[model samples]
Target: MLRLLTRFIGLLLLAGGFIALIVDGTRSIAGGRLLVTTLNKGASEFFPALYQGLQNGVSEKSAFLWDPVFTTLLLLPISVAFGGLGALLIVLSHKQETTPRYWRR
Candidate 1:
C-alpha cells in the first residue's frame, strides 16, 4: 500500500510538473498581447524601461538571465529524475508468477 501511495504521488507530481511547464510556456504569447495592449493605451514607457532594466542588470546580482538558467538547470534534473522513477516503478510492478499457489492438486 505504501508503495502504491508513493508511486501515485510520484506520478502525480510528474504529470503536474509537465502541465505547469506547458501552461507557463504560454506566458510568452500572453505577454506579447499584454505589451500590445499597453502600447495602445500609451503606457508604452513601462515596457522599455523594464527591458532596459533587465539588460542593465548585473548578471550575478540580478535574475535576468542567471535565474532562468539556474531554474532551468534545477528543474531539468528533477524532471528527469521523476520520469526515471516512474519508469522504474512501471518496470518493477508485479507480474504473474511462474510458481503456483499451494492448493489441492
Candidate 2:
C-alpha cells in the first residue's frame, strides 16, 4: 500500500516537472535565449509565505546551511529538482525480484 502511494506521488511530481520543463522551454524559445526557472523562484511564486518561513527557519538554524547548502539546492532548475526527486522516490520504492524468471522452476 505504501509503495503504491509513493509511486503515485512520484508520478505526480514527475508530471509536474515535465510540465515545468515544457513551460520553460516555450519561454526560452519565445525570448530567443536560454532561460530556466530556479527552484527558489518557483517555490516563492507558488508559496510565498511558506518559502519565506523555510528560509527563516534554515537561517536561524545555521548561517552556513542557509548560505551554502540551502542556497545551492534552491538554485537548481525546478524541473531538475522535482524530476530528480521523483525519480529517486520511484526507484527507491521499486520492488526487487530475488529470483530470475529463467531460473525459476
Candidate 3:
C-alpha cells in the first residue's frame, strides 16, 4: 500500500515537473525572445505617446491602464523559474541505482 501510494505521488509529481519544465523551456526559448522583440517595437513606437499618457494619468490621479502583454511577458520569467524548481524536485526524488562498472568507462 505504501509503495503504491509512493508511486502514485511520484507519478503526479513527475507529470507536474514535466509540465513546468516544458513551460519554462518554452518561455525561455520562444516566449521570452518574442517578448523582447515585441517590447522593443512597442517601446520605440509608443515612447512619446506613453509619456503624454502618463502625464495625463498623473493629472487624473486615480486611473491606470494595465497591459496584458506586460503580464504575459512577466509570466515567462515566473514560468521559467517554476519549471526549473520543479525539474530540480523531480530530479532529486529519483531513486537512482548505482551505475554498473560495465556501463562505465
Candidate 4:
C-alpha cells in the first residue's frame, strides 16, 4: 500500500512538472518581445545592483543571460528534477523484473 501510494504521488509529480514546463514554454514564446523588457523590469525591482551593473554597459551576451530566454532555460532543470525524482521513486517502489545472477547460481 505504501509502494502504491508512492508510485501514485510520483506519477502526479511527473505529470505536473511536464505540464508546468509546457505552460512556461508557451508563455515565454508568446511574450518574446516582452521577454528582456520584463526581465530587466523584474531585476530592477528585485535586484537593483544587478540591474545597475547591467545598465552600466555589461556585454550584450552577459545582458542577455538575464533575459527571459535564460529564465526559461533555468526552469528546465527544475522541471526535469521533479520528473527525475518522481521517476526515481516509481522505480524504487517497483519490484525487480529479473532475479540477480548471483542468486540464480
Candidate rank order under TM-score: 2, 4, 1, 3
- For model 1, residues 15-85, the per-residue Cα lDDT tens digits are 75465445445654777642211211222244667645544564647766656663454344333444566
The TM-score measured for candidate 1 stands at 0.33
Tens digits of lDDT, candidate 4, 1-105: 999999998998788668756765776799883222233344567899876776565446575755655556434444565678788888888977676687677
How many pairs collide in each candidate, listed in order? Answer: 0, 0, 0, 0
Clashing pairs in 4: none
Output the better candidate (3/4) by lDDT.
4
Q: Candidate 2's C-alpha lDDT?
A: 0.92
Number of clashing pairs, model 2? Answer: 0
Q: Which model is ahead, 1 or 2, in terms of lDDT?
A: 2
lDDT measured at residue 31 in model 2 versus the true structure, 0 to 100: 98
Error of 3 at 15 (Å): 0.9
Which number leads on TM-score?
2
The lDDT values for all models are: 0.51, 0.92, 0.51, 0.66
Off by over 4 Å in 4: 33-77, 97-105
| Model 1 bad stretches (over 4 Å) | 28-81, 96-105
Worst 10 residues of 2 by lDDT: 96-105
Each model's TM-score? Answer: 0.33, 0.91, 0.32, 0.49
- Which candidate leads in lDDT? 2
